[model samples]
Target: MTEPAAYLPVLQTGRWFAHLPPDFAQPLLAMAHLRQLAPGEVLFLRGDAPCGLYAVVRGAINISGTGGRADEARAAMLTRLEPPHWFGEISVFDNSARTHDAHAAEASTLLQIPHEPLQAWLTAHPQHWHALALLLTDKLRTAFVAIEELALLPAGQRLARRLVMMAEGYGQWTAEGQSRRVIGISQEQLSLMLAISRQTTNQILKDLEARALVRVHRGEVEILDLAALRATCY
Candidate 1:
């Protein structure tokens, strides 16, 4: 496969790769190959031999289980990869088959690097491990927050928080410096993420819309007042 034009930003912007030793970054970049996925295409299936890491250059990919204890989307919403975000690293790190399925939620561009190449590169730069450790620590904290929300927060509050979180991750600044998102997610998707029924999701969203906290249009929800949303979560 032909190598990507540049994988540096993919790695540098990712929580996992940003701290790599400078020496390790170059070789890792060399191993990356660019690929495009159409909407609804499967990037990989669960239990497939792990190849390497995949980082999104543009668009969205949804990670979910194919077969495991729960073996369904309800079990997890593993990760949603947007531009400059990495996914599929868990499989690479463990040197095992993929534990989940990665599918394009929209037309997407990705950079995929082979695990063997990445491992060889990392071996040559032992100091890079420190950054990986820090990345994992932060991930653990994030995981804890998810667990806490599921255990203690109501479904409406959880939905509100999840929206705010996605906005933080993908919203762009407007001319007035107000953050706006172009996310095209649906009520059913939000229902799944919040572990609620579609009807409930619709009701909550309608209430938010009535309050001018958010706007719902065809296949999209725009957060109009983030402060109101933060308040809604409480």
Candidate 2:
């Protein structure tokens, strides 16, 4: 048996793997390989064959699509996933090509679990199916929220909601013990995620800054007032 890598502890902390029984999760650790990715690196492109499951140990992954435009200007981001999140399961479950492209939003560390061994193990341990089902359900719920926001809310409200979600879901505590949400994304990326024009996104961000709700900097947005920011989600 292969000795677990030093980073196996980090993978064990992930929500998807943490709840599994020790007997089940231990084998997965042995099969997992750690991968380091540079900023803007493409992990896999859409339509690539399913290879395995991936969990982010550090930094972020941008899941996006490239549209039909010749210049690829019509590309849009679906979501940004940070540490303790797993992806690639959709393709693994169906044995289909990747549905979207995954890129490293920053320098990142990932754990890749190859499909063949995982599938074989899962076949023998059908009792673990519920965990996989729960994971898929959470992803679906997030998609539903994004769809509702895009269809019913104005651009400003949608942007606000996005910011709040980012802060709450991925933020960290400051040295002073304050809740500080730092979104490591550019304005253009934000606009793409929100499905709005960059100019509109900038205008809304400026408004939020003026109101002391957030501080927008190059390549990042810092949540200064999380409560007020959450209020805008309504």
Candidate number achieving the greatest TM-score relative to the actual structure:
2
| TM-score per candidate | 0.83, 0.89
Q: Candidate 2 at residue 11, lDDT?
A: 60
Off by over 4 Å in 1: 1-3, 6-21, 66-76, 170-180
lDDT of 1 by residue, 85-105 (tens): 666667656779987788899
Tell me how candidate 1 scores on lDDT.
0.71
- In candidate 1, list every pair of residues with a backbone clash: none
Give a tens-digit lDDT track for model 2, residues 131-173: 7776777788878988998899999999988887776553221
Give stretches of model 2 more than 4 Å off: 1-5, 8-14, 69-73, 170-180
Score candidate 1 by TM-score against the native.
0.83
Assess each prediction's global lDDT (C-alpha) against the native.
0.71, 0.81
